[model samples]
Target: MTNVKRKAIMVSLIRKMKEKGSWTGETHIQKCTYFLEEFLRVPLNFNFILYKHGPFSFDLRDELTALRADNFIEMEPRRPFGASFMPGKVAEVLETKYSNDIDKHKEQINFIVEKLANKSVKELERVATALYVKKNEDVSKDDMVGQIRELKPHISKELAKQAVEELNDYIKEAEHNHIIL
Candidate 1:
């Protein structure tokens, strides 16, 4: 699909997420969108790379900025430092316009958001970074924790181990559902 269409779909998807009480924060948005395109095959062409916060895409950021500019979403800074994306005035109109496409992928979107919605940003960072490590390296499950810490020295070993376990769970479910990861 064209970039324009994809952006419209993203707007609608975010609105749906908000309605479902899944719009936790920016990290939620990033990870959910990553799963939407990479695992669920929504085809938004985000060139994700293993960045500090795990899978990140400049294209996604640009699209979000454009959405803000168009008043489809608003970013509000939370106390003590992070931000959240809330639906703006135009979000409902955009959601309605793209209702059919959003509805088509609603199952995947809901599954992803529900699975990931409650995670804190730190937990998400650990999980996403661990997933990146698993995808890019040939480390065994036994050594996954150490391997992850080697790349991301700041994470506690306990958190690294937990992240590996969480990533394994996600992988297993994805495989069971025949969703390519």
Candidate 2:
């Protein structure tokens, strides 16, 4: 898809996430976009790596900055946490123009947003890291938990195991719904 359409989708995602009561911080968007691309197989083309919080994409960061500049999204500061993202002035226009593109992936978007919108950043980190390990390394579920702990020593073994199990359920659900091939 074209860059404009992708930007529209990003805006739509931000809007949907906000509607679903997500914090809509950059971290939230990053993780949700990671699942949208990696788990749901959307061709968003953001190159992710296991970073400080979890799967992160500097490219997506830059795109977000550009979206802000173009008035496709705006950031609002929230006390005690950080700034959150919201749809900007022209966001609706872009969404309307690219509604078809967004519609094509709406089911996947809804699935991920529903599963993840209410999660805390720390939870996102653990689960996304679990997915990263599962996808990048050839390991069993138990071994993936070990890798998660190795990568994120801050997480407890029990939490790591739970994250891995949650990721497994997400994968199974995505597969059963044909969200992933």
Candidate 3:
């Protein structure tokens, strides 16, 4: 798909996520977008890397800025916390334009939004990082824990281990549900 189409889909997905009343924060939006592109084959291609809160993308941030500029989404400032996202005037039109494609992947979208959107930012950091590690496939469990701890020194070793285990379970569930191939 064209970049324009992909972005329209992203904006539409963001709007749908907001309507669910579950994914309001910037972190939730980013991670949900990541899962849509990376896992559910939505083709947003945002160049994510393992940042402080797990996979982050400057490209995605830019797209969000564009969305704000285009009035497709509104950002509500939260002081020390990051801004929350709400649907803007253009959201409904974009959503309707992309509804069929979005509906085709509703199960994966819902799974991602419901499962990860409600987690605290810290917990999301752990989960997203663990999933990143799991994606490498060759990384041993011990190595995964070490990597997670090294990246997030504040996290306990036990917690890191648990996160990896939980991520493994999620992978299995996704595969079973055909959310991932």
Candidate 4:
């Protein structure tokens, strides 16, 4: 996709995330975009790695900075929780210009946002890390949980299991609907 199309998707994500009552922080955008690319295969072309919070893309981070610089998104301070992102003054114009491109992947975007928009940062960390491990490692379900716990010792075994289970459900649903290839 073109760079402008990618920006449109990002703008739409920020807007929908806010509308869905998400924190819309940098971490939220990072994890959601990770799922959009990895799970739904939207081809945003971000190279994600298991970072401090979860799957993080430095490229995407840079793009977000550019979006802010270009007045396509605004950072709003939320005090103790750090700053959150919001659609900027020119966001709607970009969205309008790339409406067709955005619509092509609308279902995938909405799927990710609906699944993750309301999750707490901690929850996102656990679940997204589970996905990272699942994608990057060859392991059975039980081993995946063990790996998740090992990767994030802060998370309990039960929570890791739950995250893996949730990830499995998402995969199954996506496959059923032909969202992922």
Q: What is the clash count for each candidate, in the order shown?
A: 0, 0, 0, 0
Off by over 4 Å in 2: none
Question: Residue-wise lDDT of candidate 4 within 1-181, one digit each (tens)?
Answer: 8888899999999899999999999999999999999888898999998788778999999999999999999999987899899999889899998999988888898889999998999999999999999889778989998988887888899999999999999999888888773
User: Clash number for model 4?
Assistant: 0
Q: Which is better, 1 or 2, measured by lDDT?
A: 2
Best by lDDT: 2
Order candidates by TM-score, high to low. 2, 4, 3, 1
TM-score of each: 0.84, 0.98, 0.89, 0.96
lDDT of 3 by residue, 20-108 (tens): 77547878887887777676666667888988688888888898898899898898877667788887887778778877766766777
In model 1, the worst 10-residue window by lDDT is 15-24
Which regions in candidate 4 have their CA more than 4 angstroms from the true location?
none
Best by TM-score: 2
State the lDDT of candidate 2 residue by residue for 1-181, as single tens digits.
7899999999999999999999999899999999999888889999998898989999999999999999999999998889899999989999998999999989989998999988999999999999899889779988998899899999999999999999999988888888872
lDDT of 1: 0.76
lDDT of 1 at 173: 82
In candidate 3, stretches whose alpha carbon ends up further than 4 angstroms from where it belongs are: none
Candidate 1 clashing pairs, residues 3+ apart or interchain: none
Cα lDDT for residue 103, model 2?
Answer: 96
Model 3 global lDDT (CA atoms, 0 to 1):
0.78
lDDT scores in order: 0.76, 0.93, 0.78, 0.91
